[model samples]
Target chain A: MKFMSNKTLKMSKVLLSAVLSVGIIASLSGCGSNESAKNSATPPADSAGSNLIVSQTNPIVIDKEAKTVKVYTEVNGKYFVEPTRHGVVFKDGSNGSKSVLKAWGNQNDFYNGLVDIGAKPGNNLKLDSVGVAVEGDPLDVSITWAGAGKEIPFGDGILDSTKKGFDFRFGGNQENAKAKNTGCILCLDSCPVGITSNAAHPTKDFDNKIAEFKGNQEVLPADGTPVVVTFKLK
Target chain B: MNTKQRKWLNVLGSGLLGFNFGFVAALLLAQWTWLELRVNTGLAILVGVGIGLGIGLLRTIKRPLAVESISLLAMLISLLGIGDAQISSLKILTGYTIREGLLMPDISLQVANLIFSLLTLGSILSAIVLKRKISG
Candidate 1:
C-alpha cells in the first residue's frame, strides 16, 4: 500500500513537471511567426449587395459615391491596464496598451480606400521639435457596433478623460529611415496620421507618451466584439 | 527550518502556483472565447487570487521547501511561455504593421521574457539554497 502511494505521488509530480516544460516551450516557439503570411492567405469578408469595393485579401470596403471607407475591426485594448489612446489603426501599428481598436484591414488599403472616395492627402501637420513634417487628410471617424445597435461618433466612443481633445486626421504612414513604409494608418500621436488638434503631439513607433485618450466602456462594446469603422472625408 | 515554517512555505508556494496557473488559463480562455464570455482582466485576476488563496489556506500537503519552490517556478515558466505564445500568435494573425520603416517590435513579449527570466533565476537560486539548508 505504501509503495503504491509513493509511486503515484512520484508519477503525479513528474506529470506536472512535463506539463510545465511543454507549455513554456510551446509558448516560446511562437515568437518567430509572421503576420504577413496569414494576411495573404485569408480573403476579406464579403460585402455583397452594397456599392462598396471590398478587396480580395484586405478588410476594407470603399464607397466612392458615399465618399467614405469602412474597415472591419474589433473593440481592443482596455481602460484599466493600458488606456485607449488611438481612435483606429493597424493592429501592429499602435501600442496594444493604448489602442482602442486593432483593425483587421491593411493600413495602405485603408489609405487608398480614402483616396478612392476623393479625400486628397496633403502635408499639413508639422512636428517642429522632431523636424518632421506629416501629411494628413481630415477624417470624420465613427464606430458602428453590432452590440450597441447604433452608430457612435468618434468623440462618443473615445474620450479625452482630461477633457482636452482633438479631431482625428488620416496621416498616411511614411517610409522608415530605411525607406520602407510599414503601413501605419492612423495614430493619436502626430505620425504620418495624427490628431490635428495637437500639432505638437510627438511621433512615436509604439508607446505614446501623451496618453490622455481612453475608450468609453459604457458606450463601447466589450473587447473583441466585432464592429465596423467608417472614415468620411471632412 | 522548523516544521511550521516548512508547512507555511508549502502553502504559499501552492497558492502562488495556483494563482499563476489560474491567471494564465484565464488569459488563454479569454482569447479562445474572444471575450464574448465576458472574461475581463478584473475577473481573471479575481478568480486567480481567490483560487490561489483558497488552496493556500485549505490544502494540507507538507511538501519540502525546495520541491515547492521548484514546482512553483516550473509552473510560472510554463504559464509565461503560454502567454508568450498567445501574444505572438495574436500578433502574427492580426498585428503585422510597420513603424519607422520596420515591423513593429514585440514589446509585450520582450517585457514578459524579462520578467520570466528574473523569476526563473530566483526560483533556481532559492531551490539550491533551500536544498542545502535542509541537507545541512
Candidate 2:
C-alpha cells in the first residue's frame, strides 16, 4: 500500500508540472502573437512630412472662387478625416458650428473612427472643397474631433474670400487646437472643398494617435509652420 | 488515505484540469477571432461536454457523486474563463482604451454569460450522468 501511494504521488507531481509548463508556454506564445499582430496593423509613418500641424494663430484661407478652402497642415504629409462623405462643413452663422459636425453613427463611434485624409503614398489631401456651402461671407467652419461633441471654432472672425485683394485671415493659437478640451486647429470646413477618408471605413491601419494624441503631448508639425494664405475679400 | 478519500481527490484533480483546459481553449478562441465570435450557448455546451468527458476518461472515477460534483465545478470554471476571454476580446476589437473598455456597458455580455452558463450546466450534468450509467 505504501509503495502504491508513493507512485501515485509521483504521478500527481508529474501531471502538475506538465500542466504548469503548458500554461507557461501558452501564455508566452500568446504574448508573441499579440506583439506581431500589433506590429502588422500599425500604420506606416515613413512618408515625407508625415506630421499634422494644428494652426493656432494662422487663419485657414477661404477661396470662394475655387469654392475650396485651402487647409494648411504644417506638413503637406498624410492626414485623415472621419465620415468620409461630409468631412468638413460650415455651421451657418454662430450656432457654434454644431449642426455642421453631426456624429456619423453613435457618438461613441466617433472616438476611434477618424478616416485618414492624406497619409497614403502619392495620395495627398492638398485642398478640400466645402460641400455644404458654395458661396457665403463669414461662414462658420468646423471639423469633428474624435468623441468630442463640440466644434472647434476658427475664431469668431469672418472673411469674404471672393473680394479682390481681400486678404482673408482668421486667428487662434495652435495650443488650443492641440488641447484635448479644445476642438480642431483648422476649421477646414469653411473651405468650399469636401474631404473624404482614404477608406470607406476605418481600417486597422487607422492611427488612433493622430486623432487622440493620448500620451504624446508635444504638437510636432511635420513640415514647418503651416502655410498661411492671405485672402482678398470681394 | 482511504479509497473513498482517494476517489474524491481524483475527482477534484480531474475537475481542476478540465477547468484549466477549457479556460485556455476559450481564451485562445477569443484571441483568434478578436471577439467577433462570442462564447455563446453552443460553444459553452461544447466546452463543458468536452471537458467533462476528458476528465471522466482521465480520472476513471466510478463514483457517480464524484463525477457529478466535478462536472459542476468544471463547468462553472469554464464559464468564468469564457466570460473573461470575451471581455478582453471586446477591449481589443473595439479599440477602446483599457479604461473605456472596462467601463463600457456589458449588457450583451451579461446576456451571453447567462445563456452560456445555463447551457454549460445542462451539458456537463448530462455528460456526467450518462458516463456514470455506462460505467454501472
Residues A45-66, candidate 1: write the lDDT tens digits.
3243474433333468877766
Worst 10 residues of 2 chain B by lDDT: B91-100
Total clashes in model 2, counting residue pairs 3 or more apart in sequence or in different chains: 28
Model 2 chain A worst lDDT window (10 residues): A75-84
Global local distance difference test of model 2: 0.29
Model 1 chain A: lowest-lDDT 10 consecutive positions: A34-43
Question: List-wise, what DockQ does each model earn?
Answer: 0.04, 0.04
Best by lDDT: 1
TM-score of chain A of each: 0.62, 0.20
Cα miss at B20, model 2 (Å)? 12
Residue B88 Cα positional deviation in candidate 2, in Å, after optimal superposition: 9.2
